[model samples]
Target: KKVSEFIGKTTNNVAEYTALLRGLELSKEFNADEIEIKCDSKLMVNQLKKKWKVKSPNLKPLYQKVRLLLSAYRKVNLIHVPRSIIKAADKLVNKAINSSLDKDVEVHFVEEETESTLF
Candidate 1:
Protein backbone atom coordinates (compact mmCIF):
# COMPACT_ATOMS: atom_id res chain seq x y z
CA LYS A 1 0.00 0.00 0.00
CA LYS A 2 1.09 3.57 -0.76
CA VAL A 3 0.08 6.82 0.86
CA SER A 4 0.89 10.46 0.10
CA GLU A 5 -0.46 13.83 1.06
CA PHE A 6 0.32 17.57 1.23
CA ILE A 7 1.23 18.21 4.83
CA GLY A 8 1.94 21.89 4.25
CA LYS A 9 5.35 23.54 4.68
CA THR A 10 7.64 21.43 6.87
CA THR A 11 11.23 20.29 7.12
CA ASN A 12 12.45 17.11 5.41
CA ASN A 13 12.72 15.44 8.82
CA VAL A 14 9.12 16.27 9.65
CA ALA A 15 7.94 14.91 6.31
CA GLU A 16 9.84 11.69 6.89
CA TYR A 17 8.28 11.30 10.32
CA THR A 18 4.81 11.89 8.87
CA ALA A 19 5.36 9.10 6.35
CA LEU A 20 6.54 6.82 9.14
CA LEU A 21 3.45 7.55 11.20
CA ARG A 22 1.17 6.76 8.28
CA GLY A 23 3.04 3.57 7.49
CA LEU A 24 2.82 2.43 11.11
CA GLU A 25 -0.89 3.09 11.20
CA LEU A 26 -1.43 1.16 7.98
CA SER A 27 0.62 -1.76 9.23
CA LYS A 28 -1.52 -1.99 12.33
CA GLU A 29 -4.64 -1.92 10.17
CA PHE A 30 -3.27 -4.82 8.12
CA ASN A 31 -2.71 -6.82 11.34
CA ALA A 32 1.03 -7.01 10.87
CA ASP A 33 2.85 -8.67 13.78
CA GLU A 34 6.32 -7.70 12.71
CA ILE A 35 7.45 -4.60 10.86
CA GLU A 36 10.84 -3.53 9.59
CA ILE A 37 11.15 0.15 8.88
CA LYS A 38 13.89 1.28 6.51
CA CYS A 39 14.63 4.96 6.27
CA ASP A 40 17.17 7.13 4.43
CA SER A 41 17.23 9.78 7.13
CA LYS A 42 20.00 8.95 9.53
CA LEU A 43 18.79 11.29 12.24
CA MET A 44 15.28 9.93 12.15
CA VAL A 45 16.44 6.32 12.27
CA ASN A 46 18.82 6.96 15.13
CA GLN A 47 16.34 8.97 17.13
CA LEU A 48 13.60 6.41 16.69
CA LYS A 49 15.98 3.63 17.77
CA LYS A 50 17.15 5.70 20.77
CA LYS A 51 20.67 5.70 19.45
CA TRP A 52 20.75 9.48 19.23
CA LYS A 53 19.16 12.14 21.37
CA VAL A 54 16.40 14.26 19.86
CA LYS A 55 17.89 17.74 20.22
CA SER A 56 15.48 19.55 17.99
CA PRO A 57 12.46 20.94 19.81
CA ASN A 58 10.26 20.51 16.75
CA LEU A 59 11.11 16.84 16.40
CA LYS A 60 11.01 15.80 20.05
CA PRO A 61 7.26 15.18 20.11
CA LEU A 62 7.36 13.36 16.79
CA TYR A 63 10.13 11.14 18.10
CA GLN A 64 8.08 10.27 21.16
CA LYS A 65 5.04 9.50 19.02
CA VAL A 66 7.06 7.09 16.87
CA ARG A 67 8.36 5.34 20.00
CA LEU A 68 4.78 4.89 21.18
CA LEU A 69 3.73 3.43 17.84
CA LEU A 70 6.62 0.98 17.95
CA SER A 71 5.29 -0.44 21.21
CA ALA A 72 2.09 -1.63 19.52
CA TYR A 73 3.89 -4.21 17.39
CA ARG A 74 5.14 -7.55 18.63
CA LYS A 75 8.46 -6.98 16.89
CA VAL A 76 9.83 -3.97 15.03
CA ASN A 77 13.18 -3.17 13.45
CA LEU A 78 14.33 0.27 12.40
CA ILE A 79 17.12 0.29 9.85
CA HIS A 80 18.98 3.14 8.24
CA VAL A 81 19.66 2.62 4.54
CA PRO A 82 21.42 4.64 1.87
CA ARG A 83 19.29 6.73 -0.45
CA SER A 84 20.25 4.66 -3.49
CA ILE A 85 18.46 1.61 -2.07
CA ILE A 86 15.34 3.65 -1.34
CA LYS A 87 14.62 4.78 -4.90
CA ALA A 88 11.02 3.64 -5.01
CA ALA A 89 10.04 5.62 -1.93
CA ASP A 90 12.03 8.55 -3.30
CA LYS A 91 9.94 8.45 -6.48
CA LEU A 92 6.74 8.46 -4.46
CA VAL A 93 7.93 11.49 -2.52
CA ASN A 94 8.94 13.25 -5.71
CA LYS A 95 5.62 12.50 -7.34
CA ALA A 96 3.79 13.92 -4.33
CA ILE A 97 5.98 17.04 -4.33
CA ASN A 98 5.54 17.65 -8.07
CA SER A 99 1.80 17.13 -7.92
CA SER A 100 1.56 19.57 -5.05
CA LEU A 101 3.41 22.20 -7.06
CA ASP A 102 1.21 21.75 -10.14
CA LYS A 103 -2.11 22.83 -8.73
CA ASP A 104 -3.51 23.51 -12.20
CA VAL A 105 -3.95 19.83 -13.02
CA GLU A 106 -7.52 18.63 -12.78
CA VAL A 107 -8.96 15.10 -12.81
CA HIS A 108 -12.57 14.03 -13.18
CA PHE A 109 -14.25 10.66 -12.94
CA VAL A 110 -17.26 9.62 -15.03
CA GLU A 111 -19.64 6.71 -14.76
CA GLU A 112 -19.05 3.75 -17.12
CA GLU A 113 -22.42 4.31 -18.80
CA THR A 114 -21.52 7.93 -19.64
CA GLU A 115 -17.97 7.22 -20.90
CA SER A 116 -18.89 8.59 -24.36
CA THR A 117 -20.15 11.84 -22.84
CA LEU A 118 -16.78 12.49 -21.14
CA PHE A 119 -15.06 12.37 -24.51
Candidate 2:
Protein backbone atom coordinates (compact mmCIF):
# COMPACT_ATOMS: atom_id res chain seq x y z
CA LYS A 1 0.00 0.00 0.00
CA LYS A 2 1.14 3.52 -0.80
CA VAL A 3 -0.23 6.97 0.03
CA SER A 4 0.89 10.44 -0.90
CA GLU A 5 -0.44 13.78 0.26
CA PHE A 6 0.31 17.46 -0.18
CA ILE A 7 -0.16 18.89 3.31
CA GLY A 8 1.09 22.32 2.43
CA LYS A 9 4.32 23.72 3.93
CA THR A 10 5.24 22.16 7.26
CA THR A 11 8.17 20.95 9.26
CA ASN A 12 9.72 17.69 8.20
CA ASN A 13 8.86 16.10 11.52
CA VAL A 14 5.21 17.03 11.13
CA ALA A 15 5.21 15.55 7.65
CA GLU A 16 6.74 12.36 8.97
CA TYR A 17 4.10 12.09 11.67
CA THR A 18 1.34 12.78 9.16
CA ALA A 19 2.60 9.97 6.95
CA LEU A 20 2.61 7.61 9.89
CA LEU A 21 -0.91 8.65 10.79
CA ARG A 22 -2.07 7.90 7.26
CA GLY A 23 -0.39 4.50 7.26
CA LEU A 24 -1.95 3.62 10.58
CA GLU A 25 -5.36 4.65 9.38
CA LEU A 26 -4.96 2.37 6.36
CA SER A 27 -3.88 -0.53 8.54
CA LYS A 28 -6.91 -0.06 10.76
CA GLU A 29 -9.12 -0.06 7.71
CA PHE A 30 -7.74 -3.51 6.83
CA ASN A 31 -8.19 -4.69 10.45
CA ALA A 32 -4.53 -5.51 10.77
CA ASP A 33 -3.54 -6.71 14.23
CA GLU A 34 0.14 -6.19 13.84
CA ILE A 35 2.17 -3.80 11.74
CA GLU A 36 5.77 -2.85 11.09
CA ILE A 37 6.44 0.75 10.15
CA LYS A 38 9.64 1.78 8.43
CA CYS A 39 10.62 5.42 8.40
CA ASP A 40 13.68 7.47 7.49
CA SER A 41 13.31 9.99 10.27
CA LYS A 42 15.35 9.04 13.31
CA LEU A 43 13.67 11.68 15.44
CA MET A 44 10.21 10.40 14.64
CA VAL A 45 11.24 6.81 15.24
CA ASN A 46 12.81 7.58 18.57
CA GLN A 47 9.85 9.66 19.65
CA LEU A 48 7.41 6.91 18.81
CA LYS A 49 9.57 4.38 20.62
CA LYS A 50 9.42 6.65 23.72
CA LYS A 51 13.20 6.78 23.92
CA TRP A 52 13.09 10.49 23.22
CA LYS A 53 10.60 13.06 24.37
CA VAL A 54 8.43 15.12 22.06
CA LYS A 55 9.54 18.60 22.99
CA SER A 56 8.02 20.54 20.19
CA PRO A 57 4.56 21.91 20.95
CA ASN A 58 3.61 21.42 17.32
CA LEU A 59 4.33 17.70 17.53
CA LYS A 60 2.50 16.98 20.76
CA PRO A 61 -0.89 16.68 19.13
CA LEU A 62 0.47 14.49 16.37
CA TYR A 63 2.23 12.36 18.93
CA GLN A 64 -1.00 12.01 20.82
CA LYS A 65 -2.82 11.04 17.67
CA VAL A 66 -0.22 8.36 16.97
CA ARG A 67 -0.62 6.96 20.44
CA LEU A 68 -4.38 6.88 20.10
CA LEU A 69 -4.21 5.03 16.80
CA LEU A 70 -1.55 2.64 18.06
CA SER A 71 -3.71 1.54 20.95
CA ALA A 72 -5.99 -0.24 18.50
CA TYR A 73 -3.23 -2.54 17.32
CA ARG A 74 -1.98 -5.56 19.24
CA LYS A 75 1.61 -5.08 18.16
CA VAL A 76 3.48 -2.42 16.30
CA ASN A 77 7.15 -2.14 15.48
CA LEU A 78 8.77 1.04 14.32
CA ILE A 79 12.02 0.84 12.42
CA HIS A 80 14.38 3.56 11.30
CA VAL A 81 16.19 2.96 8.04
CA PRO A 82 18.42 5.03 5.84
CA ARG A 83 16.74 7.32 3.33
CA SER A 84 18.41 5.44 0.48
CA ILE A 85 16.19 2.45 1.23
CA ILE A 86 13.10 4.56 0.53
CA LYS A 87 13.94 6.13 -2.81
CA ALA A 88 10.73 4.95 -4.39
CA ALA A 89 8.64 6.55 -1.67
CA ASP A 90 10.61 9.75 -2.05
CA LYS A 91 9.83 9.77 -5.75
CA LEU A 92 6.17 9.32 -5.02
CA VAL A 93 6.30 12.25 -2.63
CA ASN A 94 8.00 14.37 -5.25
CA LYS A 95 5.38 13.39 -7.78
CA ALA A 96 2.61 14.33 -5.40
CA ILE A 97 4.21 17.68 -4.63
CA ASN A 98 4.75 18.52 -8.30
CA SER A 99 1.23 17.53 -9.20
CA SER A 100 -0.25 19.63 -6.41
CA LEU A 101 1.90 22.69 -6.99
CA ASP A 102 -1.08 24.79 -7.97
CA LYS A 103 -3.75 23.20 -5.85
CA ASP A 104 -4.27 21.28 -2.64
CA VAL A 105 -4.49 17.61 -3.37
CA GLU A 106 -4.06 14.29 -1.65
CA VAL A 107 -3.45 11.08 -3.57
CA HIS A 108 -3.59 7.49 -2.46
CA PHE A 109 -2.64 4.41 -4.45
CA VAL A 110 -3.36 1.03 -2.97
CA GLU A 111 -2.22 -2.16 -4.69
CA GLU A 112 -4.74 -4.86 -4.09
CA GLU A 113 -4.07 -8.58 -4.03
CA THR A 114 -6.11 -10.69 -6.38
CA GLU A 115 -6.11 -13.72 -4.13
CA SER A 116 -5.37 -14.66 -0.57
CA THR A 117 -2.72 -17.29 0.09
CA LEU A 118 -1.84 -19.15 3.23
CA PHE A 119 1.80 -19.51 4.12
Candidate 3:
Protein backbone atom coordinates (compact mmCIF):
# COMPACT_ATOMS: atom_id res chain seq x y z
CA LYS A 1 0.00 0.00 0.00
CA LYS A 2 1.19 3.49 -0.85
CA VAL A 3 -0.44 6.71 0.22
CA SER A 4 0.24 10.36 -0.62
CA GLU A 5 -1.11 13.67 0.58
CA PHE A 6 -1.66 16.89 -1.38
CA ILE A 7 -2.70 20.03 0.42
CA GLY A 8 -3.94 23.57 0.53
CA LYS A 9 -5.98 26.03 -1.56
CA THR A 10 -7.97 24.18 -4.14
CA THR A 11 -11.56 23.47 -5.00
CA ASN A 12 -13.26 20.48 -3.40
CA ASN A 13 -13.50 18.69 -6.70
CA VAL A 14 -9.82 19.12 -7.47
CA ALA A 15 -8.80 17.96 -4.04
CA GLU A 16 -10.98 14.90 -4.47
CA TYR A 17 -9.25 14.06 -7.73
CA THR A 18 -5.82 14.57 -6.23
CA ALA A 19 -6.67 12.11 -3.52
CA LEU A 20 -8.02 9.75 -6.16
CA LEU A 21 -4.88 10.03 -8.23
CA ARG A 22 -2.76 9.22 -5.25
CA GLY A 23 -5.02 6.30 -4.50
CA LEU A 24 -4.55 4.99 -8.00
CA GLU A 25 -0.81 5.26 -7.67
CA LEU A 26 -1.05 3.31 -4.47
CA SER A 27 -3.18 0.65 -6.11
CA LYS A 28 -0.65 0.21 -8.84
CA GLU A 29 2.14 0.01 -6.33
CA PHE A 30 0.22 -2.70 -4.53
CA ASN A 31 0.00 -4.68 -7.78
CA ALA A 32 -3.77 -4.73 -7.61
CA ASP A 33 -5.43 -6.67 -10.39
CA GLU A 34 -8.60 -4.73 -9.81
CA ILE A 35 -9.29 -1.56 -7.91
CA GLU A 36 -12.14 -0.49 -5.67
CA ILE A 37 -12.19 3.26 -5.26
CA LYS A 38 -14.38 4.78 -2.59
CA CYS A 39 -14.96 8.47 -2.30
CA ASP A 40 -17.32 10.60 -0.24
CA SER A 41 -17.46 13.43 -2.73
CA LYS A 42 -20.52 12.97 -4.89
CA LEU A 43 -19.36 15.49 -7.44
CA MET A 44 -16.03 13.72 -7.95
CA VAL A 45 -17.71 10.36 -8.29
CA ASN A 46 -20.27 11.73 -10.73
CA GLN A 47 -17.64 13.54 -12.73
CA LEU A 48 -15.57 10.41 -13.14
CA LYS A 49 -18.60 8.51 -14.37
CA LYS A 50 -19.56 11.22 -16.85
CA LYS A 51 -22.74 11.84 -14.91
CA TRP A 52 -21.40 15.35 -14.35
CA LYS A 53 -19.20 17.42 -16.61
CA VAL A 54 -16.16 19.24 -15.29
CA LYS A 55 -16.34 22.90 -16.25
CA SER A 56 -13.45 24.21 -14.21
CA PRO A 57 -10.04 24.23 -15.85
CA ASN A 58 -8.44 23.21 -12.57
CA LEU A 59 -10.36 19.96 -12.63
CA LYS A 60 -9.96 19.00 -16.27
CA PRO A 61 -6.37 17.76 -16.03
CA LEU A 62 -7.07 15.88 -12.87
CA TYR A 63 -10.07 14.27 -14.51
CA GLN A 64 -7.93 13.22 -17.42
CA LYS A 65 -5.31 11.75 -15.10
CA VAL A 66 -8.02 9.78 -13.33
CA ARG A 67 -9.32 8.49 -16.63
CA LEU A 68 -5.85 7.41 -17.62
CA LEU A 69 -5.16 5.65 -14.34
CA LEU A 70 -8.48 3.84 -14.59
CA SER A 71 -7.51 2.57 -17.99
CA ALA A 72 -4.57 0.68 -16.50
CA TYR A 73 -6.79 -1.39 -14.29
CA ARG A 74 -8.30 -4.55 -15.71
CA LYS A 75 -11.37 -3.91 -13.61
CA VAL A 76 -12.15 -0.69 -11.79
CA ASN A 77 -14.96 -0.20 -9.36
CA LEU A 78 -15.62 3.35 -8.28
CA ILE A 79 -17.96 3.74 -5.39
CA HIS A 80 -19.63 6.77 -3.79
CA VAL A 81 -19.32 6.17 -0.09
CA PRO A 82 -20.55 8.01 2.95
CA ARG A 83 -18.03 10.22 4.71
CA SER A 84 -18.12 7.88 7.65
CA ILE A 85 -16.49 5.17 5.55
CA ILE A 86 -14.01 7.50 3.87
CA LYS A 87 -11.73 8.79 6.57
CA ALA A 88 -8.45 8.12 4.77
CA ALA A 89 -9.15 10.15 1.69
CA ASP A 90 -10.75 12.86 3.74
CA LYS A 91 -7.58 13.02 5.78
CA LEU A 92 -5.56 13.54 2.64
CA VAL A 93 -7.41 16.77 1.90
CA ASN A 94 -7.12 17.96 5.45
CA LYS A 95 -3.43 17.02 5.49
CA ALA A 96 -2.85 19.63 2.82
CA ILE A 97 -4.06 22.35 5.13
CA ASN A 98 -2.27 20.93 8.16
CA SER A 99 0.55 18.44 7.82
CA SER A 100 0.07 16.94 11.26
CA LEU A 101 -2.94 14.92 10.18
CA ASP A 102 -1.07 13.07 7.44
CA LYS A 103 -0.34 9.85 9.20
CA ASP A 104 -2.08 7.78 6.58
CA VAL A 105 0.57 8.68 4.08
CA GLU A 106 2.58 5.51 3.96
CA VAL A 107 4.06 2.98 1.59
CA HIS A 108 3.27 -0.44 2.90
CA PHE A 109 3.96 -3.87 1.51
CA VAL A 110 1.85 -6.75 2.76
CA GLU A 111 2.00 -10.26 1.43
CA GLU A 112 -0.98 -12.55 1.64
CA GLU A 113 -0.27 -16.22 1.80
CA THR A 114 -3.72 -17.79 1.92
CA GLU A 115 -7.20 -17.55 3.36
CA SER A 116 -7.76 -18.05 7.03
CA THR A 117 -10.39 -20.10 8.78
CA LEU A 118 -11.41 -18.38 12.00
CA PHE A 119 -14.63 -20.22 12.46
Top candidate on TM-score is 2
Q: Write the per-residue lDDT of candidate 3 for residues 15-119, one digit (tens) a residue.
A: 778877877776776776677665677788778778789898999999999889888777767666677555655554565657634455543222322221111
User: 1, model 2: CA deviation in Å?
Assistant: 3.9
Candidate 2: misplaced stretches above 4 Å? 101-119
TM-score of 1: 0.78
lDDT score for candidate 3 against the true structure: 0.67
Cα lDDT tens digits for candidate 1, 15-75:
8988888778778877776777777888887677676899988888887888788887777
Candidate 1 ranges with C-alpha deviation above 4 Å: 101-119
Which model, 1 or 2, shows the larger TM-score? 2
CA displacement after TM-score superposition, residue 108 of candidate 1 (Å) = 28
Worst 10 residues of 2 by lDDT: 110-119
Q: Is candidate 1 or candidate 3 better by lDDT?
A: 1
lDDT of 1 at 74: 76
- Give the C-alpha lDDT of model 1: 0.69
**Sequence-dependent TM-score of model 3:** 0.72
The predicted structure with the larger lDDT, 2 or 3, is: 2
